[model samples]
Target: MMASPYLQCDSEQKLQCHWGLLLPPGCVVIQTSSSLTKMGCGSSIPKNCKVGGKGRKRHSIIEEVAVFVPTIRIPVDSDVVHPLRGLVSKELVDRLSKLRAHVVSLSEEIFLLTESRLEASVEFRWKTLDDDQECCVSSAWYEVLSVVHMLAMLALFEANLMLIPKDGQVGGERKVSEDAKKDVVDSLLKASGCLDYSVHHILVQIPAQVKKSFPCYLQEGMLEAISIQALAQCVEIQLGLASECEKATLSVKRRLACELVTYFSQAHYCLSGCDTSDSYGKKLLLFLKWKCMEAKAVAYYYHGLVLDKGAEASNHISAVCCLSAAEDLVTDSKRACLSFCLASPITRVPPPWGIMKNMHKKIPDAAYRKFQMYGYLFEQDKNSAHQSLPDLPEFALSLKPEGYELPSTDSIWDNVDSQPQIQSLKEHLNDEEDEVETK
Candidate 1:
C-alpha cells in the first residue's frame, strides 16, 4: 500500500516524511501512482477526489509556460518638402499675363475703330442729298461719335487699370519703378489724345454739316448734345492728364490749357444754338449742358493752375479771371438747373423719371469746391508775380470777363489745322453766302 503525502502525523512521523515540509498547515495533498496531486483544505472535499478507494481516479498536473514576441519599428522621415511650397503655379501666372495682354489688345482695336470712323466722317460730303441719303449720312456721323466716345472710355479704363498696384504692394505706398510710372503717364496721355481726337475730328464737323443740310440735322438736339458732351469730356481728360503728370513740359501744359478754353467755348456756343423743345432731347441736352458747365469749371481751374506756374504776370492775372469765371459758371448752372427742376411737372410725381432723375446733382458743389481751392492758389501766384514785377502796369495785366466769348467756328477751326476737305467746305459755305448777298 502507498502512503498518502497529505496525511497528518506526529512530530516524530513528520520528521520521517520528506514531502511534509512543503505542505502548509491544515492542508491535505492527494498523491497518485502516476503524479502528485494537491487539493485545497476545506470542510467538504470535491466529488473528483476519492480517499483510499480501489477505484481511485488518476490526477494529472498541467504546467503553465510563457512565450515572448519580438516587436520591430521602422523609422520614418518627417522632413519631406513639397515641390511648390505654397507658391503660385507657373500655369496660373501665365494665364493672368495672357488676360492683361488681351485687355491691351482690345483697347488698341477700339482705338483703331475710332480712327477709321473719324476718317469716314471727314471724307463724307453733302451734295443734294435725298431723304435716304441724309439719313445714311446722319447715321454714319452718329456711329463716328459713338466710336469716339467708346474709345475715350476704354482708354480711361486702361489708364486706371495701369495705375492699380500688383500683389504685395502696400496700399499703393510701395515705390513703383520709373518705367511703370512712365507707362501710367503714357496711358493717361493716350486717353487725352483720344478725347482730343473726338473734339477735333467729330464735334467740329457738326457746324459744317448743319450749314450743308440746313434744317435736316438740327431738328432734334441729340447731335448738338453729343458734340457738347464730347467737348466737355475732352476738356476734362486734358485737365486730368495735366494734373497727373507734374513734370510735364510747360508748352504741353499751355497747349492743354488753351485747348480747354477753346473746347468749353465751342460747347457753350453749340448748346446755345440747340433746340431744347423735344422732351427726350431736352433731357439729354440738360444733362449734357450741366456736365459741360461742370467740366468747363474744372477746365478753367486747371488752366488757372497752369497759368499760375508761368513766368508772366499777365498769366497770373489771367489765371484769376479764369478761376472767377469758373466760380460764376458753376453757381449759375446750379441755380438754373435747380430752377428748371422745380418748375418741371416731373417734380410733382413721387419719383421723377428721365433726365430729371438722372441729372448730375453733385457736379455744382464739386466744381465750386475745386474752383475755390484753385482760386486760393491763383491768388498766391498773383501776389508772387506782382512782387516780382513791381513795375508792371495793372491795366496791362487786367483781364476783362466780358471780353471772353466764343470764337467763330471758322476761327476755332483755323486755330487747329483742319483737313483739306473741311477747309474746302468752309470755302464753299463762304461762296454760298457771297451768292446770297449778290441776290
Candidate 2:
C-alpha cells in the first residue's frame, strides 16, 4: 500500500517527512489504510496544538479594519456683511474712497438753492403795497417755516445714505455733546425772542402806518386777523419738545400757548369789521378766522389740563365759552352765518334735557341731535366730553363731498407771475435724487 502524504519517516524509512517540521512539539498524527492499518506520528502534543483548547481566543476582523480608517469634519457657510461698507465691496475699497471728497459738495448745492428761494419769496412780499405792517410781520415769519422745511428735507436726503455700503462709520452719529445741547437751547431761545419782538413791532407799527391809506374801512382789522393766523402757526410749530429744550426745567410751550390765545382773541375783535364787498381781503380774513377757530377749539379741549392744580370756576366757564364759540363759528359758507349766530347763545349755556324738551319753538331733529352730541362731547364731564370731538357726521356738514372734482388753482395762476418763485423753489427741493445716508 502507498504511504499517506502527511506521514513522516526517518532516512532509513525513505525520508517522506520530518516529524519536527510537520507539527508542534508533542503533537500526534494518525494514518490509516484500506485494510484498517493505523499509524501515529507524535505523542504528548502541546495543549495549544489541540483544536478548541482552553486559553486560545478568537479575534474580530472589524476592529483590525477600523484601525487604518481616518475621520473628517464638515462646516456650513453663512453669507452676511457689515453695515458700514459704503457702496463698495472689499475688492473696490480704493475706488469708493473718492466718494468722501464729494459728500459735502452735493449738500452745499442744495442749501444754496433753498436759500435763494427764501430770499426771493421775502423780496416779493416786501414789495406788496397792499399788505400792512402786520402783514409784513406774518410774511417775515415764513422764514421760520422755510428753514424748518429745509432742515427736514436735508435730513431725508441724509437718511438715504444708509443704503450705501460705507467704508467706515460717519462722524456726528452719536448724541450731541452737553456743550452742543446748551448752544442749541441758547439759539432756539434767541429765535423765540426775535419772534416775540416781531409780533410787537407789527402790532404797534401797522395801525399807525397803513390805517389811513387802506381803501376799505376794515384794513386795520384785516391786518390784525392775519397776524393772529401767523402767531397761531408759530405756536403750533414750536409747541413740540425740542431735544435741548427738554433738558431745561422750564419750557416755552405754555407761554407760546397763552400768546396764541391772546392773538386769536384780538383776531376775533378785528374780524367783526370785515365786509363781504372786499372779496380778496374777505377771503383772506375768512381763512384767518378759520385758523383762529381751530386754535380756540384745541385750546378749549386742553383747558382742563390745569384742573389738577385747582383752576378757578370762572376759568372753566370762559373755557366753555371759547369751545362753544369755536364750534358755532366753524363754517363753510356765508349762508350758514345767521344759523350760527342764532345757535351761539343756546350753545354757550347748554341746559338739561328737561329744559330742551320745554322749548316753545320746534328744531330740526338732525340739528338738535348734532348739538346734543357736541354738548355730550365738549360740555359734559370728563368721560362724556371726550366723546364730543368727532362723533358728529362731519361729511354732512362738509362743503366738499366725496368723489367731487374741483378746478385747479394752478390753471388760473398760469398767466400770473405771483406764484412762479414758489413753484421754482418746490421744484428745486424735489429734484432728482438717488440715495442718501446718515448714521
Q: Give the number of the best model, judged by TM-score.
A: 1
**TM-score of model 2 relative to the true fold?**
0.26
List model 2 lDDT by residue over 1-439, tens digit each. Answer: 2222122222323221211111111111111111111112122112233212244343321111000001101111111111112222332222112221111111100011112222222210111112222212222123222222222222212221221123322221223234432333232222333223333432243334433433332244543444344344334334323212555222233344445556556656766776535434544444455445544433433332222123644434433444444344333212232233233121111111111121112222323443443444344455443333321111111111112111112221123432223225544344322112211
Query: Model 2: residues >4 Å from true position, as ranges?
Result: 1-218, 240-255, 271-276, 308-439
RMSD of each candidate? 45.7, 43.5
Cα error, candidate 2, residue 102 (Å): 38
| Backbone N/Cα/C clashes per model | 0, 15
Taking all chains together, the TM-score of candidate 1 against the true structure is 0.29
Q: What is the lDDT of every predicted structure here? A: 0.35, 0.28
Model 2: weakest 10-residue lDDT segment is: 64-73
Instruction: State how far residue 218 of model 2 sits from its true place (Å).
Output: 9.3
